[model samples]
Target chain A: MGTTGTDIRYLVIIGIAVMLLLFTSFLLALIFNQRKKLKYQQSMEKLREQQQNQLIEAAVRSEETERHRIAETLHDEVGAILSSAKLHLLGIKSDILDERDQQLHEKGRELLNEVIQKVRGISHNLHSNILKEFGLNEAIRHFIRKIAQGTVLHATTALDDNYKTENPDNDISIYRMVQELVNNILKYANATEFIVSSTHRGNELDMVIFHNGDGLTQEQFEELRYQKEGLGLKNIQNRIILLKGSIHFTSGSEGYRINIHIPVKSNQP
Target chain B: MKLINFIRDWSEVWALLIPLIIILVFKPAKKQLRPVILYVFAGFILNFLATFMVEYYYLMPSWTYTDGYVNNNILYNLHSFVRVLFLGWYIISVRQYKFPFLLKTLLIFYLVFVITNFTFYESPFILSTRLYAAESITLLVICLFYFFRSMQDESDINWLKHPSFLIAAGISLYEVITFFIFLFFYPLHQKDISFAAVTMRIYTITFVVFCILLALALYKSRKKSNLSGVTG
Candidate 1:
């Protein structure tokens, strides 16, 4: 029996070896399958990203077309009528020669001119040709200048010298992203100083905005990531990622800071 | 010891021959081409090695041989070592043919520790043939636990529920019963407990049970495959 035990033990050893080999093969198959599945999932995610971008682009084009139509209507129809009305009023006031009535006519003409200018300004903000002509830096300057006139924002920008040569699509996206950020900052941050700066190091570009103001809580940031519509932040993230860039936001005791970085030359394709 | 050897040799012949006979008679459920190849390589290597270890490298058991000469060949132990490893993988991968190759290979290496046992050592004290059988069955049970869990559409297997597997399981139970006897009586006298009786009781019963179940399994699988072809 002892002799038989010795023989059986050998068989058991063989059995053990067989089991080990099979299990190893199974694990290898699992890893291979997992990688393949992950690759497929990544491709699907990429397709979804492309579809969302196409939708955003279509919306932007639709809005731009609408703005152009409005701008045309104001300049051609309303602007001509206002000018004609002003000329007629001046002619009439000269004929009257009564001081009080003449003064009132002059004041009325000035008000009419102001109204016409304000209407033109609104049309330009909707979609401006100046943005396309001078590129983003000058356009942003004009934008901040106009916003500053109304609010005590003191909006200052430090765009690098090479801003003109930026990728036009990226520039447009940056402008839109910044505009959204500023709108949120104005309404919610309750800040005093708003400074926006762009820095260039080799092929890399970094844009930062600093606000000396009340900051958001950790819970608010968590909500932004998890639940809230948070279209503004989401939009910012989408644009940066599309540009193959990165965006970071930090809340400090002093205020909140946001920074965006992108590799300019290498990421062109 | 001589009687036990006779019974064990008969049991092993039955284990291999019955499976062979069933395959010749009725085909498997699935073609089972892959496992067939793997099992052949595994079984051959394991059988050869086990024979070698018992016959040679292990402290020659004071058991009777053909010419009263103890065989000692390095090839025997080496092959036996390899066989144990192969069996480890076979039983583990026996349930599902989908186990990874790396795991199978690693399992083979892992089985080496079993030979560190006293069965192959100078003195067969702690790690005896019974202990080896017990370990093999336990591991096999663990490996097939999933196979026996529930019946699925592709494979309606419930090992615990299957009487056929229970027959194979008898092999394990018998080994355990013998181990207890050995443990109780071993200290007193080696000759008093008949090695012949235990081997006859264990191997004869276990081998017959294993052969019957294997034959049944082969028949069922063959019938299934034939039905599948007709339906298709």
Candidate 2:
């Protein structure tokens, strides 16, 4: 009986040691797995952040580019026409002082009026008052109509009325984001048909942009994500997140899909 | 003969009904309408009727229950039915997901085993009781592997966030413990094992521990779905 008791105690000690060993091993394994997963996630996040930085930078550059474009238009086209009109006015004053000369002066005055009208058209192109007065939906509608009729590509929109953003600046962001995505489609995605869907759930907005094109392969995507570091994609995502949103990209048999979810509080009045 | 006929009469109904309940209630995607309606439902119906025949006509309990003839009542038979439905769903899900070659081969192997379970020369006493028990347990393991492999690639379907894999792990580990008990008492009839049996008994206590872990994993997984921005 004493021998049996001794054996039992020995067995109990061995059991404790064995249990501790197994537990430590299991815990270490779990920790290792979690660490590996965390590393993977961090790497993925860094890639996205870098990509977004590029897009934001590009958006900022595009705004500047638009400024330059307008400046160039004003200087080159309008400036040249005004110079020509000044030359005509000078020519009439020196060469002819008769009634026939006065008639030529009237023609120059009419040409000046036409040049003013041209400047007004340029101002409208730079900042369409239709956007402020009509709201985003209508502005987008007009934009699409203009683009569709003008361009070979077909663009369609699906808007969810329930989704609204609390931040007023989001209106511009929304416009720009849509503009960027559509721009990508116009530039990159080859297939003709494209879709832009926005769903408005309470305090959240889900936007899906899909296009059929010769898209990047998974490896190509990863490579471009690291190597090319697109700025347009980044700007859209950063702007979305500024509205408290997240974005993801996936490619499958359907081609490339971009799903962006924006967390919002209230609608535009 | 009277007793045999009585059990046999109700056997078909129990076999069909029990499996039908399991398939309709427990099997995932039962409520799903399109595409999966006919395929999944058809399999459930056939498996249900097949079980009915196996229960009443094939493996009816005619002998005395005094020694070791299903120590539990008819409700215990649901265990058998659950195992069948579980395996049936496993095959369908695996086929849908296109499981890895290893798991597919294992499934085909299991079917072969089930077919041969009949040809095994058995003691008449063990035939009715242990045969189905053995089959159910073996299929459970195979089914667990099938589901496990299928889940590795099943990312788009996040309804329950991989609940099937969690359940499979829980059920499989539970059966492993229970199978040892069976092996000790009936299969090998090991009268005593000084150290090995002691280890197994201690291992059985950890079943609850593992179960708690499984539950926690499932709960965490559900919370993960909420963390994501998936639209309904």
Candidate 3:
């Protein structure tokens, strides 16, 4: 066995130490590269999701515009023509015609009045002028009053007096969603009682509907929403999505309940 | 001096125990890592045989000329050859590079060079410092390749938590630090016995640390397997 001097040993040790330091630095760089890659992937996923949501929003807005146009056409063009016809028939003097002919003219005017009312009702259902002029609360009240007159199904409502939306379009969408939900109940649920209530707290709005009827479980609701026969539920879902809101359905032996929450500020525009 | 003597005495036991533990603990869970585990287990057996032959030669010095060469040197050379073969297999198996033909050609060239040097130039009885240096540098390159390819992977895997990454890191760190040490082994042995002893101590310490990292890799692989089982 021979011996090398101390200087050479010291140099070797320093060299080994340097190599270890370099390896440590390389490991750090590898970790940084991985983290940067993960962050980039996450940001890309978020951008894709934002783009999809924007597309949905644009579609809902176009649909509302089309419905408004149709409602205006039915109300202004068709209803005005029917009303003028009724007016001219009423103006025909009873003294200028025999009894049977006068009776026939009066009957024709009555039928024209009925037709005019039917057209006006359809136009209102398509796009409610009441919702645009007076806001969501009055619109819902008027809707409930109309239903109560038409059906034996007892309907009740409790809406916040202070509930106000800066965007009338948002108000119309919310009103339409509630209308769809009630329509679903009328068509499907053989329930004796339907109850609706709403509240506004800070920038949030909560609406609940309850009924003693055959109800849907969460799975059933999801299944129905994607089916062809579930257009009303689908429409309600689309409007809620447009509002950036959430809806929950609860069902039990006693009844069915739906709870909805919307951030009013987030729904603006 | 006492610590150095202790490490020298028990280094073979440590080597054998580490790989044995890895096989027993992770073999059941690591189906994908079977080849690596097999290589390690084989290396451990080869190391044991080499150590036994060297110890027997020390006990009976006159019984070494059966094949016109020292049995200890033959055993050590065989051990080095087998170790390099397995290491090459590990690298090729885990490599993500596209040029498989080029990598295989380089590996074949390295094998030819090692055989020619051992057969013609370097005596089997002498330490093959040049071959060891070459092996260390090649392994370092392979480890670097693994890191680079992993960086390019699209899947968001936590490299720090990955078993293969941990093993590659350990190998890279050990190889880089020991490359010069291997190159200077014969020179240091000829010039200074004490310096050589110190260098051997450093190598043993690095080897032990490398073994610990390997054990951690096995443990992490086992944990990952169990998690996948639970989730699946």
Candidate 4:
């Protein structure tokens, strides 16, 4: 071949090489670009999850704080006034009153005492001072006593004595969650018998509520918790999340059961 | 009659005016589109001037000086240089951030090649066949890159309606067909004048097709903007 033929042949080879180089570069860019996009999506999903957890924590804290404030007001202001009224009634002399007046004084003293007791009970229910002073075991016992007085649910609890949490806030949240679950069993489960069991295993506290009646299905539980009428269940869920706990709901032919596991130490910063 | 033949021979030069006029009349809404339209218009003016100079030299042979000053071939070389430069600019702008460093290095190399061709390998008075071949190959590569880049884009706009895709398609088609013609121009022209003339006609036809595609791109861009304006 002549010089011109040789040059043309070289140009053809050069053209093929250029095309191959571009094609390879394009493939590499595409692969890297997709990998980068996937990473970005994962980071975005993580950020969204973090934001949701923070919101739930804030809500649970605010609700607990409000409950404490109301309880304090009832105990301090209302309980004091009623106690004073009962003391004054007690100070009235029998000789200064006719039979009818004496009878009225006695009745008035009895009513004042009942009102004082009722107010104190309401305050205690709102914020359990027993849970704060004593701990989770005493609080559960007190709760069972309160529930046993009103209903025929035949409630029973067995909490490990050694089980303790360093954070009272976390304990209150866990207690509230258990309280809500028990209330749910009482109101909806229609069970003749209910059981509450708690144990400390390793760094985790496991609490289970088991009842012998038909309860909500998993789908129903999820759906209900999102509904407007399921505020109580939603509150329980938020408290569990605040305590860095996990809850499982299971239903069988026998009954429904709720098992919750909370870490002894809170994971919150 | 001779003037008619001259016009027929340079039909691609005249075809460039069509897109230039259309783009100016429709006026793309995007500010970024202005550079592309301005370059196309510059190309049209350049082609028209080159054709005119070549025709004038042919008609007035007596006016030509023996001292190698100004001629048709030099004007053709200048036209090719400007066309490659503008097309490169368009591709680089469209690719934007996605344009690879390797392509940039290749562009620098192409620039150097053009300078060397004009200065040493090929004189201004001679047809720079090698440079034309290199331009076609480089442009073909750029057009293919545009295609691959467009494929990777997640834009909702229909690919068929995309202005850049349409322009790339047109450029790719032209380059694919004309590359071999440019590669073998010197040898073929040395062998037979008829073969060269036939190849030139094919070049004119492909050039006309490319201009039509560009005009369509401008029209699509204008329509897209109008639709967005009405909906927005």
TM-score per candidate: 0.51, 0.43, 0.56, 0.49
Off by over 4 Å in 4: A1-24, A93-108, B1-232
Minimal lDDT window, size 10, model 1 chain A = A7-16
The TM-score of the first chain in every model comes to 0.79, 0.52, 0.80, 0.80
lDDT of 2 by residue, A1-269 (tens): 33353354355446446545643454345445545655666787789877765666566557746855785677577767786776766666534568776786787777776776667545454543455576656556666665566567777888775544365455656666776767667777776877778877777667777888765443443344334467665455457555656666678886788787776665456
Question: Which is superior by TM-score, 1 or 3?
Answer: 3
Give lDDT for model 3: 0.74
User: Which digits, one per residue and each the tens of the lDDT, describe model 4 over residues A1-269?
Assistant: 55554465456446545644654575456556656656666787789878887898788878888988998998998888888778777887978899999998888888888888888888998896899899988998899778878667688888888787677878888889888888887787788898898999777888888899777665676778789999997887777666667777877777787888887865546
- Name the weakest run of 10 consecutive residues (lDDT summed) in model 4 chain A: A4-13
Local error of candidate 3 at residue A234 (angstroms): 5.4
Candidate 1 lDDT over A1-269, as tens digits, reads 35454445444345435544654454344345545655666787789878876776666556557877898788777878888887887678455578887788878989999978977777676665677888877877787777777677778989886755456666666777777777788888888788888988887878887888775543464468455578776666566655667766777777788777776663356
| Model 3: colliding residue pairs | A2-B191, A2-B192, A2-B193, A3-B191, A3-B192, A4-B192
Fraction of native contacts (fnat) of each candidate: 0.00, 0.00, 0.33, 0.01
Return the top candidate by lDDT: 3
Q: Which stretch of 10 consecutive residues in model 3 chain A shows the poorest summed lDDT?
A: A1-10
Q: Candidate 4: how large is its RMSD?
A: 16.4
User: Candidate 2: misplaced stretches above 4 Å?
Assistant: A1-35, A80-87, A90-108, A120-269, B1-117, B123-160, B185-232
Clashes of each: 46, 8, 6, 0
Which run of 10 residues does model 2 chain A get worst, by summed lDDT? A1-10
Q: Report the lDDT of model 1 for residue A262.
A: 72
Model 1, residue A96: C-alpha shift (Å): 1.6
Error of 3 at A243 (Å): 3.5
Task: Write the residue-wise lDDT of candidate 1 on B53-120 in tens digits.
Answer: 55564455665232555443333234334433433444444555454554465454445544455346
lDDT of each: 0.57, 0.52, 0.74, 0.74
Ranking of models by TM-score: 3, 1, 4, 2
